[model samples]
Target: MGEIIYLRDQHFAEFHDKCFLLLSASNHIELSRQLTKTLHHMLVTKNTPVALYHYLPTGQLRLIYYFSFGSNIEYEDEISSIRSFEALSHSQLTYYALNGEHETWGYVAHPPSSYIGSTHWISSLVDIAMHQLGLLSAKCIDRQQAKLKTSRRLLSKDIHLFTNIEEILDRHRQRWRDIFHACGICLASQGALHRFGHCPSDHQLLQQLSWLSNDAEQTDVIEFEGSHQGSLAVKLSLAGTHHGWLLLFRDQPFTNKHVDSAIHRALSCWLTYEARMARVLADDLALTIAALEISHTNRQFITTAQQLASLKPAIHSAPRAVTSAEQNNK
Candidate 1:
């Protein structure tokens, strides 16, 4: 702490601000190696391992940079789940929020245990300075992406993705299955689980358990937070004559509105299938009743024909026609 403390530090601030302003105010979305390495060295003096983890609102971690050639992908993976949900490291090696209020961008880079409470203020100061500037960079990137997506959509000839209703439903069903390991959709009407898709080899066990896990009593959406806020689940009904829950599970909370919109759309798709099935079944039942009625009428006609034939035989035995020629002969 005492080393960096000085009356005038024009040299350090000038060097640090050069990289900071370049990264935060640049038109390019991609981070160059040179700028990042310079910036890392400026603030992160840790000869110890450090990694910059960019967290998505979906609760996924993307590695931005790793320093000191100490930690590799394995180390990053080990702590990814913890970073996704936990606000603090296990060691409590101070992490800067970098605008935790908006969840715009926050990273964790724990130094050596020696720096736990010592001289870490400089690192925290760097993060605080990066906050306002990072927001600007994030907004610019978002706008650029929005325009690209809009352009792609406009250039496409068709908006509808699938040719048939079943295709669309199947796509959604597959998405449901991917929400978690061996994820699936189950029917509430069936006492036994009726899994729709994403069946792993061991999914049979999951199928048996899905029926029991449905505690969704209300029609509105319900959120369940998992241990240490590391996992999140949102439950809503795919309701109709036979209602079932549409659920999503993620490593982090489902705070993204876009994700919520997609979930609701899936629920709507399921509801549409339910309504269509009801209509189809009613149509089939009507056709079945008509067929049975026709068969019954045909049976009655055959019985009447047989009765008429029997009467013809009785007439032949009981009566004879008188002729005028026979009367003249008498």
Candidate 2:
């Protein structure tokens, strides 16, 4: 028997009080940490360990946060990587999948028989917490973006997050033009690449860009060299292929310590917007399918009309009975 935290029921005042802790979190990590603690406190049974995972585009879940009450599980030794869940489920754990339609993530657990809160209640609270985190993420990015914009020394942080792809790119091209006092910048993500300046986007972008697409749990902005000419790039990435890059040209040397930080903050908002657009594109694909169906039906009608027109010539060529008055006149 492992050491167990004190059990708490769903309907108690302490439950909501504890749940309110999730709302006060300032960032993703803090919010998730509170979540794990909340889960641990609710369950009465020892060895009823719970691990949180984020779903990736490659159909694997990456472990983000894990909570246990003195369980000796080997997998919990490290809190990283995209290990297969095949071996995990063999332990007879109950996986409560979250973000159902979006395929984001879920929690897997080995709850004992004497668990305090009902599984349904736990699941609902977990989902609500995740939803709260989403809202918190938006607010955090907004506040940070505003704060960082003022910190920029030279150029204006006038970029706007919009739904339309082209418009957003246009705004970025205009705003990020003077990232470092005439040092041009380029933004790329989601199958589209555009370079705003003459900086060498080929070799540097091709080599280091792959690192951001990995399954590692992203928590910080990845910054690295663009080229040997003192150029640099700031990367903002989330789960799976949801990532973007901001490359600055070597036009002007930047000495500001927080230049990358501002870009990082803005890029977070950009990635969030792009991810939302990816979901919107699904709806767009359905509309396209509907349009294609209509086009196919129209083509069929046109083909039938063409066939009727061709047959009309054959009918006209064939001898037809003339009117009696016409025959008499002939």
Candidate 3:
């Protein structure tokens, strides 16, 4: 019987003119009805396409909820033609997991353009919004889990840890190689670093990331050409103050379609899990220190714990509306 919580007033402002609401409630038909009822007023006022993303509780979090409204010309034409499909015009509701089990509820819609050459900006905005909401929901769950000692789970299951920094870098390198192979893309060459200092290859591209500033948590996609033409460089800043970058290269460029969205979604999920894992690791370290009768005031132990604490995942304090200016730039 967990309580349902809605996003704050600031988040509502971020929704802009479009109707958007994010809430956390238990997974049940009754709760879904409650959500539908809540959005009823919006639906009547503007029959824009509605999307709901339901996130179930994991070992890390408690409640999950997502709702959005926008107009998609392509989806309107497609769904409206379906006979007897009675929901608000071009509306859909989806239920999915933050970590596992991929499922979309209600009528699904695509980006409002052909998937081939178009930028699909409208759909991309919706997708990114949903992704951000999902991440935020997971952060909420992690916060709740932190309050219960018995609920803490192992972070190693989600994040791979090494004894040293070098090992971590090597592991990331190997992971990129694996991802390229699995995605049917060849990896020409790749490198990862903390601050994009100096790199032999892709120096200019890596340097571009510097402009994003240390506080930018969003993913940046860069297209490059060299031995492997049409390659894409996906770079993301890990959660927390442990300044590190994950750079991956693929032989093919990602479209603004399903493929690109899927990759980013997967990466986002991994980072969320990694953030939770960091918390678990920090807890374990503290417990170990105590078990060994080490003084809590020990500088080394305190420093290590503080470092881990700083690595906690970045959760969006408020929702962000994708503006037309930003879309044009992209």
The clash count for each model shown is: 0, 0, 3
The candidates, ranked best first by lDDT, are 2, 1, 3
User: Which 10 consecutive residues of model 3 have the lowest summed lDDT?
Assistant: 56-65
**Worst lDDT window (10 residues) for model 2?**
262-271
- Residue pairs with clashing backbones, model 3: 61-141, 94-105, 155-277
lDDT of 2 by residue, 151-261 (tens): 332122222223333554464454444323324555555455666656555666666556555628643333232233334445533333234555544432222232232
RMSD of each: 15.8, 16.7, 24.7
Question: What's the C-alpha lDDT at position 192 in model 3?
Answer: 41
Candidate 1: tens digits of C-alpha lDDT, residues 1-330: 113333344335565454455446443123322333443454444344444455554554443333343433333334333435354355433444445444545454544434322344345444534544465556654554454344334323222343322333343444333322323443222233334653322353354235336655532233222221221122222222233333323233123232222222211111111222223322322333333445567778999999998899788898677799988998
lDDT for residue 257 in candidate 1, whole number 0-100: 37
Highest-scoring model, lDDT: 2
Residue 48 CA displacement from its true place in model 3, Å: 21
Task: Show pairs that collide, candidate 1.
Answer: none
Candidate 2 vs candidate 3: the lDDT winner is 2
